[model samples]
Target: MVNLTVTQLLRDRALADPEGVALIVQGSAPLTYGRWDERSTELANGLVERGVTRGDRVGLVFGNGDWADYAVAFFGVLKAGAAAVPLSDALAPADLRFMLGHCGAAGVVHAEGLEVAADGWTVTPGVLRAEASAQTSYDGRSAGDAVTDPPRPDDLAQILYTSGTTGRPKGVAATHANLAYGCGGKRRPFAHSRHLVHAFPIGTNAGQTMLINALDAHPAVVTLPRFTPGRFAALIESYRAGTVFLVPAMAIELLNAGIAGRHDLSSVLLLGSAAAPLPAPVAAALTGAFPNATITNYYTSTEAAPAQTIMMFDPERPGSVGRAVAGGRVRIATPQGEPLPQGETGEVWMRSPAAPRSYYGDPGSGTFRDGWIRMGDLGYLDPDGYLYLVDRESDVVKSGAHKVSTIHVEEAVFGHPDVVEAAAFGVPHPVMGTVVAVAMVVREPVTAEELRLFLTGRLAPHEMPAQVVTVGELPRNAGGKVDKRALRSSLTAPADLAPAHE
Candidate 1:
């Protein structure tokens, strides 16, 4: 019932614990709550003075390791009554320009030496101080605090861009209420110590979730600016972090690198992964990696967030994504969007009381319908209402005139002891129209025939891969989900990336 906003989440935290550690970035000084609040406030005032008004859009152009400035730009825009459009640091000039124009931002804020190709006024964190200093020429008290207005719960706080698997990325408009879920207006008691850890890329849904968790779930957040298997393990051990979140991709790397065994990772109490289904083997490996932590997998999307199905790892039901939690509801629906019987696979739809957001430019497009999001995934609810993901509707291959779930084959492939990761899709075959194809990464040398033999009885006859390929690694999008679209598009390229034959 607390009507607190995202800005209030930070303000309340600072007032309650001004000296509390807020952010911990490797090779940088830790930031305190009081400093974060004051710095963001100053930046908010600066943007306001530069004519960035309420309801305006402001772009955040920051790269990895620019956490401090990114935080300032993010909250400053929200506190200034403008929506923060967080652009990916990996964006090229063309992509950056499109988003800036797409969001129709009033201006862009970035750090010095951070290269970005864009138009309109460019504001930096230093500009806030510079403007405050320049005010001394008129009256010398100090522009002390920028008197910017706070946003309401309904106001758009952030416009996070989706991974654009289907087409160009669309801006997901998130209101204050959407971002402020689960904060409870105060920090959680430090169960093990005072820190939580994650290597989530900034500007991502997972990254933003960690940022919000740092505000109220724990006193400090330890971040891995650039993720590497060794670095990820070292940070958790170095900080004695109690809770951690990783996408399945990162978890696989950690297991492959075997750093968890080398590091003292027993301090972890909560181990969560999202953005993709964790294969049975990866889930089992993670339990061994963070032995003391509770392993959890969450199901959510950019279109339907804050509302998700959260499943604590249950070995008996290895593939389940878990039941809905945190005031969220999930249902399997027919193509017409009507609810289907339990255990029937169809489009997965999510409903949340957190006041759902919409696409910025195309409001209420087919995806958002009557308090529900299409989720773009095909899944089923167990007789017990436990949800299980199958595959993206678009990624489900029609092979040999029968629909085949890539996940079905991938799951069987992952069950193999030596397979590290696997991706299955339908490739054009003049005879079958489309035939099942698989690409994989393995722990040791394994031939395609060996894998095909292993999958013989595990999958349906039609679901069996017509061809097998071995790759160095699976390509991932910004959200850490496997880029199946990119993989499908490049299947025609040279044999270097994927070695497969009809």
Candidate 2:
């Protein structure tokens, strides 16, 4: 079993192939494995000199640049026996404050150009870079000065905050073992075969997982400083990358950018889509674009990744989320915790060794039952043991006595020939309690009456949207999922609303 900490993971890679390219960022210089490890060692020494101690929390706020520096910072913190807290740079200042305060971070390490204002103390990237390069004097002791008090499998390695789409964000405390289980423990029929092209921000769980798995398996990872369809295509062609991981929105943008036809991307072997469901049309477009690649979509959350089912497309199981990986079990249960049979829609619950042990600083219990974690998602498992997601439990629209899945309505609307994107939500209704409302972006003019009629035969009476709002674009989060709360607020204006039968 692989019991080493993330710090060790880097050290091992450094020892095995010091000259191999460990990180590459567009518009920046590449960092070799040996240089990456040595820099991390120096950063560790710097942190030690700066009073960073074991079990201390170090907050990191940065974008996807040559993050090998931050990796060194992370290892330095870990080697000093401290936990790392990486925050997405996309978050607003207020949100960043909430996360930093919530995590009780001792200090922060921010990027050179980002706007991060913290009260106590903050370390700039310049300082770490100078220290790593031995151009600046550091008072902290080196890793060799003190015996390594590395973290155990159960020790907390990092605390990641949730996206807070539904409610207040909760901190997910991931132990070294928890992350390792996600990286390697879950059973799969296939070994690591694809070179991953990661475009997500490194602070997020998706990025961290990609980093660990790539280093553990020594996959050639092509990094993009920022996600641009053109740049992504260029990297894939330049590196002859075999696999890629992208959110649905990025995939759609790539399709719109016409990068597939412009580049020689036939070397792509597997295309993995996660963070959100890939619309059927988008998935189809990708399949046509990358004909040689297999499309695999996984359903998971930040709290417990690789949790639930992974749907690898098969002709027989069109929308199935494949089967549960080893060391994990999935159950569909009612709100009352009653188990539902196959084909019955219910909340999806997952139990796995990789699941989060507990929410950081959350006193309330019941997040986990036995070993199962409530996924907060609505879905059903088919008779063939394939999982299908409908929508989030919080996003389900309650109209009078009926419950409607917004994703279903959105999917139907998006299927329209002229519609580019769509979102469905519940609006406060006087008589019905709540009514289904839809917001849409279209490529051409389409009347509300036309859309209502288009969906008449496609959706049930209760599922039919009472109003359709036309917009140029839908509000989205950093992960590219629809920001329904923002969409709800936008509908409050008079000009934005249109009658369904208009």
Candidate 3:
């Protein structure tokens, strides 16, 4: 009966709508609320019998099982008064090793196929679920005999690692209050529809957000384990999903692949994008593709859950991410840590009730101060308080005395008809201090000179990339964002990179 815990929420939904489809993964069986609650209870009781104590950290490694499996393990861990640690099925062996060791998990509850290598563990609840099918005696216990313990509102619910764009991923310790707010509660914006769809992968912050939202928002939560633009569009039609979510990278693929055109997306009423800013070009294309739908772009970080900025695509203010939502505040500050004038670009800081998170067991990033987070984004706020991002402060290139937005250059390159993917970065230069460079993936033949010419009108003379390297593919992180750091460190580093003309 804990109001703030995920366990209580799932139980309420199970009692109210036992037969409602709670989860659906591509090519797998649907899991109803009743079954979801039952499996979680069973697994929870099993974990308790196997000696998983309150506050114990249990890793979830569902490895390609239905997303429902991850869901069951997540709630089960919470129901047992244990914190859930979701392991990405896509993580490298080293990353996986680091997480397992870093969290000091007492046990791991993984699918039959998934495995984790760690030195020692006090428990391994994998056998608990593995033995469930054969143990009728295990489920024969009275309702009161199930796990009697559940996490409190302020208890650690999960530890999500950053996507690690710049360096090592840091674990974000979130309490039950943090993850349980939007779920199984009064309906909110994205959750109001009967069906909700998104292709977010497991282990990413956005994926965890959808998981939290799925509890009570929609009657059906349709998910794509793997996202191809065409597959993403087809699923919307197949399920007649009214609301769907896409990150910027996914949105770009949908537009360039022309997938939404191939499907009957008439059922879509809301097409939302998050994780990163939706490129102006991508935003425009989304509007055209889902003409019947309201296209929205949201800006928020993993650590700053529920506190976000939302915009419904205003062509007049193409770059604006919109004003802060309810309970959220945004401010622009100068590099010297002073508030900047409206319309002046500077470091962006945001604050909300949900912004009180800290890095678990690692030196803090110093991004979070007092009640606000630095956001690490450089942008301006208009007199009306609408926010517009220019670029990440660390990622922008210094050209001569002025800073150039690689995002701007990349957006222009993405606008090229033949370009499927593009990235812009700073390179060492003798006279200009540093110059802009680009790497791109194209579907058709296009000369570097042609692309260079294309940017002349779209970007300032100083902002134009001096070198462009065409590639078959651009590196991407598991969360689906382009790995700009990886790109900069690759053999294509501007130092020795050849121009596209060569």
The candidate that achieves the highest TM-score relative to the unseen native structure: 1
lDDT of each: 0.81, 0.74, 0.78
Model 1 TM-score, 2 decimals? 0.94
Candidate 3 lDDT tens digits, 10-80: 88888998998878898899889898888887777777776778888887765434588889888878877
Question: Which residue pairs collide, candidate 1?
Answer: none
The ten-residue window of minimal lDDT in model 3 covers: 493-502
- lDDT (Cα, tens digit) per residue for candidate 1, span 1-502: 4466889888887898889888878878887888888788777777777888889999998766877678767887887899999876877678788888998988888877776666788867787657744663222223545566578888889999888767898999999988886666333645566788888887688888877776777548888679999998999898888888899999989999998779999989888898888777788888888889889898888789888888888988998999888788899998778999888889999987687989998984999899988998899988898998888898888865588888888989988888988898767665566667788898898787787788778987778777777889888777788887777776743332222222
Tens-place lDDT digits, model 2, residues 1-502: 4574666666767887898776667666767778767766666666666777777788888777747656666666676677888887778889889988988888887777666777647887568556555534434543333224566777778888877877777888877777666343333212444356768776676777666654565565668778889999888888777778888878877887789889988878788888888777777778877878888887777765646567776756655666687667788997767799888999988877563556888846566666678888899988777788888888898887888999888878988898878889987765676778898888899888899889988998888888788998788876667889988876654443333221
Regions of candidate 3 where Cα sits further than 4 Å from its true position: 1-3, 63-65, 121-126, 130-145, 188-192, 334-338, 363-365, 430-433, 491-502
Model 1 ranges off by over 4 Å: 133-144, 186-193, 493-502
Each candidate's number of clashing pairs is: 0, 2, 0
User: Candidate 3 at 239: error in angstroms?
Assistant: 1.0
Q: List the residue pairs that clash in candidate 2.
A: 49-140, 310-321
